[model samples]
Target: MFAVTVDQVGSRSDDDRVEQAIDVVSTTAAGRLVLPPERTAGDEFQFLLDDAGTLLDVVFALARSDGWSIGIGVGDVEEPVPDSTRAARGDAFVTARAAVDRAKDVPEHLALEVAPGRRLGTADVEPLVTQTVRARQRRSREGWELADLLRAGHSRTEAAELLGVTPQAVAKRWSAADLRSDDAVHAALARLLTEADTPAGADTPA
Candidate 1:
């Protein structure tokens, strides 16, 4: 299992933004979530995941908006997570708390902790995912607009029409932003997480 803790960057003056972010995660992340996201305190939210593979999507939700400190922890959780973050007790949650604290000091606005030397997503994959997420966070407005349009299943031509640009220009922006490479990296990372999550004994079914 995995835990994700998120905190809004800076002061509470813009908390409506955090509330909206919470709503987006609540509505869009049901499939990947083992625990529905909850606000634990002012400007902070937390959730649990049944699959580490979905971490990338969750991070995207936090980072694409550019206003969050997102921390992900991969570790054991006490069975039957408590109904609230207050009652939750486990290494995963603790790790998430520490990671979230660290996220406040990082430029990328992301941090992660897993069982030391654990192979789930591996240390290698962690940096790769972080780099990719940072790339997304750094995207220019035009770059991100194209990415959002394409990610929503719109064709390049459609995106062009919507942005009032030529299809070739849209394609150039997409390529220049390295969106295709980022997509490929995300897919590969998801596969790695899936493989890592499978128990070695899984094939020996009872």
Candidate 2:
């Protein structure tokens, strides 16, 4: 299981954005979550999930806003899952708590913790994920607008039409945003996470 815990970056001074974040996670991870996202405390929310791809999607969606510290725990969850994330208990949840606290001190405001005794392969997953988030943070609003359209399966010409810009403009924004690199990072990160989560000696499909 994967446990994701998110804490607002500046909760004391900023308007509460927890509700909006919960909505985003819930929507993006619909049908993939082990439990519905729930507020764990003021300006904090958490959810459990099993798929690495969905985990990336949820993390990317939240990281785009740059308002939350994200911690992902990859490990085992105790049997007989609870109905609510707040009620769940396991190594995944424990690591997620520690990971979130660490995220507060990290430059990228993101962290990942694997449970004790789990051996991950050679890939440096956290740094790759952090770089992707940082790239998204650096993206301009226009870049993101084009990215969103492309992500939703729109062709470059169609995205240009929607944005009232020429296809060349959309292509330029796409290259400037380095979205191709982001897509590659996404695929690599997902594979790394899945590998990390697999039990020792388990066979992984090619």
Candidate 3:
């Protein structure tokens, strides 16, 4: 069996909600589970999965069922058989542990990438640092500032100029705001334009 963990997303502080969701996901499926948060931080969970793939499917199912978001990570096992080498156990557990910690702030539905040597790196894991930073910025206070500039038809370079900063600075800020993806930038611009078209204080949601 391999170790795995799932962490949920909350808009505010939803420690209880995260715990409840973890329990539901763990017990609903057959796995050796541990409540790390209950024992300590109240923000994470741990489990030993007989089949990692089975747990991953259940993780997604639980996220949908709870209407909450979750990030998942799995560690490598030296052997599929029980009681594998400590090195393998430590390797998988440590990497997965690190990924899980990072995922707490990442957007829902994005799985953590396993590092090289432990498990072959997945496409999902590349540039995760950039992705997570961008994800957080997209929902952050600065996200609003960047959105305003983009809606004014500013090219990224132009936006940087308008913001009185370098192009690299603009890209950094924009990427940090989670506008790195063209789809994300376009969507944010569309929302901003739509909002601007509305009268001020019209009681319409932004």
Q: What lDDT does each candidate get?
A: 0.75, 0.87, 0.48
Q: What is the lDDT of residue 206 in candidate 3?
A: 30
Task: Count backbone clashes in candidate 2.
Answer: 0
TM-score of 2: 0.93
Residue 142 lDDT in candidate 1: 92
lDDT of 3 by residue, 32-124 (tens): 433222212344555545443344345544644443433344344555434422223544466556666665654554444454533224353
**Is candidate 1 or 3 superior in lDDT?**
1
- Candidate 1 vs candidate 2, TM-score winner: 2
Clashes of each: 0, 0, 0
Per-residue accuracy of model 2 over 1-206 as CA lDDT, tens digit each: 89999999989999999999999998898888898889999999999998889999999998876789999988899989989789899989998898899999988899988876555732356777787888788899999998898889998889999999988888899999887776777888888888878767778735
* TM-score, every prediction: 0.85, 0.93, 0.42
Q: Give the winner by lDDT.
A: 2
**Best-to-worst lDDT order:** 2, 1, 3
Best by TM-score: 2
Kindly give the stretch of ten consecutive residues in candidate 1 with the minimal lDDT sum: 197-206
Error of 1 at 165 (Å): 1.5
* Backbone clashes in model 1, listed as residue pairs: none
